[model samples]
Target: MPRTPRSRSLRWADVAAWRLRRHHLRGPLTAPEPWQAVKDVSAALCGLHAQVMSSAEQAVAARTRLPDAGAAVREALWERRALVKTWAMRGTLHLLPAHELHLYVAALRDDRRQMGDRLLAQQGLTPGDVAVVLEALPTALGEDRLTREALAERLTAVTHDRTIGEKVRSGWGVLLKPAARRGLLCFGPNDGRNVTFCAPRYRLGADDERAERSTPTDPAQALGAVLRRYLHAYGPASPDDFARWWGTGTPEVRAALSALGDAVTATDIEGHRSWALRDDVADMAPAPTGDGPLVRLLPAFDPYIVGPSRQLVSLLPHPALRSKVSRTAGWISPVLILDGMIGGVWKAQRRVRHTEVEIEAFVPLSSGVRRRIAEEAEGLLAPGDGHGITVRFA
Candidate 1:
């Protein structure tokens, strides 16, 4: 007989402890090789928020010992083809494991359709027009890397609609998004100031032939796989949180959860209903209370900040501080997290000789906290970029 899964009621502290463990912040930080660490963290989070290259680099560096993390990430993308940059969850640019691209695309298939419809409607385009672009994308990209402008030109030549060319070159990502969602397009090596795109399969070359054969073909299973990963890393979360993260409807999120069956168990999180992987419930045992406050200098759009959990926001010292971390116009500033709560917002300006970091605390920080913040800033600097690091509280 199958046993009924046990229910757990969680307080705020439990969530914080789970987050620390899941995010790899509480454990020893002996770092892995740069590329391996990037792959490990990306897979752990399912993907890394990568709208800004610098933010993505810092996010990875926070977990690993890559001094020049940005260059290392680029090596993974361009040289090794180990990571892929494309439009992913919430229709934002993220760095995902290259081989798993199909799974993400399959999971978001419906959401991408809805997004496509809205974007096309705004542009006064029909589904047929999007279909045309989708058809021409693979052939247009062929085996060669093409700048956005060059690809737009080629797409224009194929569609024979000059307006399509204009839209592609507008840099708004409307026309190209569908291709990325369909796994037909991804970043190519940049061409100076211009960004380029190519078919991911072409980018992977012969390696993709083997991957495609082994990749799961079922979309429902793919959706379930992505949700399981989400719950594993960011679980004890509501369907709304999952919906917000994926930019999908609640129906889809709920359906995916249902498909997981016994794998998911219900929980009460601060009086609200949440779900988590059954095994994780045991791991959420309250952490020791004696340790001093933990501090992290998280970069903009770090997963720890960008994850769609209002519960995390409630951990802020004050409600007003929310705006500082979660800014207007999709600008999430770098943050100072002290003891699992948002302590302040921070910024770093790097020069050839040194990096200057300025922190604005919502609450006064002690000298020990300030010293810890300075140490965190030092880690962000490249080797021999000078021992000079300035951290001033504003």
Candidate 2:
């Protein structure tokens, strides 16, 4: 029998530094053009949560050496076409690198759209109606993209069912995520305030790219690939962490881990056991306990906070204060990290003249640390967002 890998004990500091490095938050990507910045950062972080476009851009900016967050992100999205924004990963909007669309869509098996038959029935939609819309999506979104309203009208025209209108009304776009997973629909460039939809170009010739004809053609393999990617970016995570992140169950995650075989290794952070990519095992070094606090202001829903199953207590050790970080109705507040632990929670409110970032620290902060936090916050500012940044403590 093969010997089990030794479980490495990790400190919260070590976990914090490693995660910050993996996320490109320790320091931005060396240097990249507007387009490459988005692609590189998105690929590195699995993908940026795009529910709030500004937040997604800030996340990229935090990871990249690029000057203007808006310029770099929009250039990659609209001009370079290097990134595709779509509903994915727990049926939420994400900014994913364009070249990896095939891998992501393949992992999201066609049968695994977000809405179930019961929910469809609740919307007065039948499976047949959903099928008709899924089939009609590609043709309607051909060549140019269409606004949600335009697509809804065309869907109604094609299906001859007015209920399709009810399904698309919510800004959340919960019902349409299924079609997006099928690779037939994605968010197109914005027409002023209106968001559009298009069929993403999933056939890229990147080194890792495969034709629809995959080598294995096994869904588990794709699932395993996704797990490997996630582990690299946010590893030393529990099986349940991946399950929750992917909206999967224990058995599915177990099988995916099994598919990795020796590619993954077990590890422990404190008393909690988790898994990490084999290659990453060698890099898990404990940050010197004597080192001064390190700080970074992460935007709301940054992959770092959402990726590792925050409930693990590794992110925020104080159980009573958990509500401050992860709030009601799934709101993850922008956070301040000190020496790899949740030292505080923060908010960046855009004022007409300036953006004020108010921090509520759970522990006292030193002047040097506060100054560093201000500098970090300035680097994350998007172009034309505000002329200046003010840091306030509460």
Query: What is every candidate's alpha-carbon RMSD to the true fold?
Result: 2.6, 2.8
TM-score of 2: 0.91
Native-vs-model 2 lDDT?
Answer: 0.76
Candidate 1 per-residue C-alpha lDDT over 275-318 given as tens digits, one digit per residue, 9 for 90 to 100: 88888888886577464567778889988777754555666877
Over the stretch 1-394, how does candidate 2's per-residue lDDT look in tens digits?
1125578788766777787778877667854467787888888988889888887877877777577777788887877777888878888889888777667777776435356788777766677766777787776667667888888877777767777654666424655778888777888788899988877753233533543445344567777888889999988887889888877666777888877888888888888788888899787775554556667787898788888854436566577888888889888788888766788899888788888889999888888888988887787763444489899899
List the lowest-lDDT window of 10 residues for candidate 2.
202-211
State each model's CA lDDT, in order. 0.78, 0.76
Which residue pairs of candidate 2 clash? none
Candidate closest to the true structure, highest lDDT: 1
Clash counts for all predictions: 0, 0
Q: List TM-score per model, in order.
A: 0.92, 0.91
